[model samples]
Target: MDFKVQLLQRKSKIDKVIGEVFKDKNGLQKTVIEAMEYSIKAGGKRLRPVLLLEVCNILDGDIDYAMPFALAMEMIHTYSLIHDDLPAMDNDDYRRGKLTNHKVYGEGIAILAGDGLLNLAFETMLDSINNDPKLCNRGIKAMQIISKASGINGMIGGQVVDLEWEGKKIDIETLDFIHKHKTSALIEASINAGAILGGAEENQYLELQNYGRCIGLAFQIVDDILDEIGDEEKLGKKVGSDKSNEKSTYPSLYGIEKSKEIVSGLIENSLKSLEIFKEKAEFLRSLAKYLEVRDH
Candidate 1:
């Protein structure tokens, strides 16, 4: 199948899983539930979950067994976006061309919504494990990886540094550190969780980790490039916010051309790391290439 066709098929499966997880319309705390659904349903690429499923497929693992982890990864990712767009954080009013959670719902409600999603993510993961005892260890490992990636040493820690350094002159090292943790950490978790649950070997696991890290960094670099050059209509958000906030980015540290070069290098490195998996990794390798040049 063509890559786009395969991507669409995978997206369909992911959407089905998401629907299954959130299907119950009748529940307690209807408002909170509604808010949670609103955030989750707001369309994004669903890239993390897609990565989870793809990695599992590559490892010859069961997609059915991976669905729960895939859903959980998306929940975690959405929660982070909710928090990242808070008034105290990025303070943005738009995401994916829709009102940010805080902008549509009050900030307090948005915060609660993000909190609710995070707690629910854990609940969802546990439920998945309950359904299959054999996967408990794998699930546990997935949980650990996600927790570490989303916690202080990972996303949140990077956010703190990003917030602290706003409008301040920062070196390239610090800028890389901020993005690697804030953005790349969760991305790494996404791919790594899939690899682990897919029963990747120790050497393969390490290669995926390296691949994830490189793509994670490249993802942010492309994001920075888009902020500078992409159309607001295509991006679903305002362009130049990074400059408006004086945030340190690759484009800020290096010129746009140099940043593009850097992103290309990272993408090359990411593809190189997949040599161990050969044909099994073709989709992921293509994904890295697509991410580097995607319009949104």
Candidate 2:
């Protein structure tokens, strides 16, 4: 199948799983649930979870065993977006071409919605372990990796540094730190978690770690490039928000052409790390190239 068709197929499966889990619960807080539903249901590329499933499939693991992890990753990602758009953070009023969660649901409800989703994600992940006792160890390890990636040492820490350093004219070292922690950490976690669940050997796991690290960095570079020259209609969000927010971006540090070069180099390095997998990693290699030229 073509790459776009494959992506859409994976995304469709993820969406169905997320939607089934996000259904209205009886006697729950309606408004918070509504906000969570809205935010999660918002259109996204579904890159993180799709990548997770692809890695699992590549390693010969059952995709069904990876679905809960995929669902949890998406929830964690959506929660981060909701919080990122709150009054104190990026303070954006629109996401994916619609009112942001905080805008339509109010800040308090939106915060609660984010919290709710975060907690529910863990719940779903932990519950998934019971289905097959034999896979419990891998499930536990995957959950740990996911949690740490989104926790204080990872995404939250990066967000903290980003806010502190915004408009500070930081050096490349600091800029790279922000990108690695804020963006790359979760992507790395997604790939590693899938590998662990799929029972990757120690050497293969190391190679995937390297591959994921490169892709994560390259992914942010692509985002920076898109911010400079992407169509709003295609992105489904305002362009140049990074500039307005005074966020340090690759394009800001290195001009557009240089940024593109950096992304290409990163993709090349990522592919090299995957050479050990040979034909098994074709999807991952294609994904890296796709990121280099993605419009949105």
Candidate 3:
């Protein structure tokens, strides 16, 4: 299948799984459920889940075995976005061309909704393990990787630093620290979870880790560039919010031309990491290039 066709097929599967996971339950709090569903259902590229499924395929792992982890990663990703858009954080009022969770549902309910998604993500993964006892170990490891990536050492930590460093002049090393933890952590976890669940060998696992790190940073660089050059209609959110908020970004630190250069370099390194996997990693390679060049 062509790349776009393959992406669409995987996206359809992910959408179905997400819908089933969020199906109605008796006595559920409608407001919180609505808030959670609003953000999850809001259209994005579904990149994290796609990465998981793709990595699993590359490793010759059963895609079915990786589905729950893909869903879990997305839930965690959505939760992060919910919190990131809150009044205390990015303070955004829109996401994916609609009202943010807090804007539509009120701050308190939105916070609860984010918390609920985080807890429920674990529940969903555990249920997946229970259904297939033999996958218990793989599920457990994947969970550990995800938990760390989403916790203080990863996304949360990055958020903390980002908040602290706003409007402050920072050096390249500090900026890298913030981006690696804030943006790259969950991405790294997504790819690593897929590899672990797929039972990739130790060497392959290390190579995938390197691949993920490069692409993860590149992803953010491209995002920074888009914020500068992209249309709101295309991006589906307020562009240049980083500049408006005075948040430090690669483009802010380095000029736009230089930022693009950095992204290209990162993409090159990411592709190089797949040299061992060669043709088996073509999808992953294409994905890295896509991330660097995609408009949104």
Give me the displacement of residue 36 in model 3, in angstroms.
0.7
Which scores better on TM-score, 2 or 3? 2
TM-score of each: 0.97, 0.97, 0.96
Write the residue-wise lDDT of candidate 2 on 153-263 in tens digits. 899888899888867778899888888988999999999999998889998899999999999999988988898799999998889878887767889888999998988
Off by over 4 Å in 1: none
Better of 1 and 2 by lDDT: 2
User: What is the lDDT of every predicted structure here?
Assistant: 0.88, 0.89, 0.89
* All models, RMSD in angstroms: 1.2, 1.2, 1.3
Candidate 1 structure quality by residue, lDDT tens digits, 22-89: 67768666676677788888888888899988998899988888888888888888988999899898
Tens-place lDDT digits, model 3, residues 79-164: 99999989898888888898999988999999998999999889888888899999889889998999999999999999899888
Model 2, runs deviating above 4 Å:
none
